[model samples]
Target: MKKQVCIIGGGPAGLLLGHLLTQEGVDCVVLERRTGDYVLGRIRAGVLEQVTVDLMKRLGLDERMKAEGLPHDGFNLADGERLIRIDIKELTGKEVMVYGQTELTRDLMEASAGRGLEVIYGAEDVELHDIDGANPHVTFTKDGSPRRVNCRFIAGCDGFHGPSRQAIPASVGKDFERVYPFGWLGILADVPPCNHELIYANHERGFALASMRSNTRSRYYIDVPLTEKIEDWSDERIWDELAIRLGPEAAAHITRGPSIEKSIAPLRSYVYAPMRHGSLLLCGDSAHIVPPTGAKGLNLAASDVYYAAEALSAFFGKNDADGIAAYSDKALARVWKSERFSWSLTRLMHRFPEDGDFERAMQVAELDYIASSRAAQTSIAENYVGLPV
Candidate 1:
């Protein structure tokens, strides 16, 4: 019936925040509208920056990740047959870990098991009440009965469509969004990746990405028109498109198989400015979204949770309201930088519908510079490994 912090949504963002707060002896409750199985089944990005990994380590959730997760020092950028490698470790002195979001969530869930952390699943019509007031509370129905939890603060970690963001008065926050004309048609197969590291390609036909989940599981994607349907793409067609977009050199290492899963994800860059509204603090997809091109979707969420948890910790530990008060401004600062990186990378690789000679030439020139200039490469590498969060 009461908690220090009531978290909406049991996705990684909500769960991670709750876990971190609990480590600080903060009392929190996580509510999810879906079953745990449903939560764990959602597949998401696998790349993580050091900041995310460090957070997991701090919460004692990185044992499995450190053991099972793959590490990559750099990734490839391709312009047709030409391969441009950006060595993140060489340029930034850091490396990214390739652990899937699902795996990380599972690790977090397991760590909290039997720790007296209350995570209620299948909560229906979850709603926030009195968020603007000093004593904010959350209400939801479980098993056809209404339940409520009063808290000092409420965290709207539920994703973009959840009710938490809508709880804020429309006049209080501004929304910025950019919907791309295309989507990533992706497939998961039990095949080794074409390369040891990820490969991003800009082809005459479209954009392509060669990535992996593990040594035996490969994830690949190619940009397609928004009108394209997953049903229209067969396993063979997907591989063929990848081959063409990846060029002869990269395609030479192709390994093909029946897809275990396939889908098309629309790309969008969205941010709800001022992540905090009174006692209701927004985190992760509930506050911001970035295109998958930069592999920033999950990492950005991690950073959001990182800032939110730190702010909450400061608030409870030292009775410091400044961290909580400035959370919105501080978080938004990093959010915009990441948005710029994701937007720039998306523009550099994808073929826009209105792209003419100059647009294409600009993309080529930028990619060339990144490949040849150490400064250009370092700029990207630092952003990729993540800036100081």
Candidate 2:
């Protein structure tokens, strides 16, 4: 009999892991707290790095994505009327696709249907049992009845709030954390995007971004105090502020409509090392989270699943655990690099109340350097376009 692996959380990480393990002839089950519809409809990250695109193509999951997703060469950094173009393909020889997380989840979930994969939805009383012992188990209530699953190994691909991380012994790993003072107030409107390329604007009022999900749908964000109230912001106020930041050229393209979605996401950077303890391994958001400024959250999560799949395949198919043992360290190496880049990008674009005059001057100087210097521009391009997974 094959060793059983119980995967917690049915997000990208868990789903991708199950897909890969199933291909390798490993028996696994996925437990998710939310229904499939809720998971598929959740709005989140939309940017896909080049490597993520490659992986999806390899998995034969990119057919719809390529058909529906918009490909962009790069974004533009705007300071009022002046614009600095960051040509990603020119610098990194790669491009990024604008496709929502909701779409990706829908695709993956559809692909996983009826593959001898057990995905329990709306699971309640979900708990990890004997995680440190040889026979690890997941206890949950399914359809108003108590149930337990005994497995040889457990994979925690749940988000930060999930119990999988809590199941890990504190002595097994160390965590590094940083929380930003600002949050992004994102809005989705039924309007055409004001710009062809994403516009990251640094303004005296705040940081603003102009992005799009489709030809008729636009996504925008503004840096606001974490305590800022959404009720205080009306549709008129939003459009007024957007016009000032997006500049006069975008005025004609901008349209007004009822916001389809709205949310405030606090910026944070967190990393947990040694992602595995004994037979339990943590992947994706359960292991790390990056600020959204760099568009690394979903991409990083996908990368984690990709690496975890490779390790699990090696360990199960070839009786080699070396790859599994090195999971956390290998993943974190890329995680921290992304964390730093995200921090750098966030600081460069956002104006903090606590920043002194000298710091403000430094910020401007750095932006100028990035806009004027070819070497600096290439560095930003390499990161923005994303490195290979």
Task: Give the lDDT of residue 339 in candidate 2.
Answer: 87
Top-TM-score candidate index: 1
Alpha-carbon shift of residue 333 in model 2 (angstroms): 0.3
- Candidate 1, residues 1-389, lDDT tens digits: the string is 98999999898888899998998889999999999999999978899988889999998778889899999999989999789999999988899999999999998787776666789998998889888889998889999999999999999989999999999999999999999999999999999999999999999999999999999999999999999989999999999999999988889999999998999999999999889988999999999989998798888888989999999999999999998989999999999999999999999999999999999999989998888899999999988888788
Name model 1 segments beyond 4 Å from true.
Answer: none
Error of 1 at 355 (Å): 0.5
CA error at residue 155 for candidate 1, angstroms = 0.6
lDDT of 1 at 2: 83
Query: Each prediction's Cα lDDT score?
Result: 0.92, 0.84
Candidate 2 residue-wise lDDT, 116-234, digit = tens? 66788988878987877778888899899988888888899989999999988888889999889999888899888988888888887888898888888899988889999888888
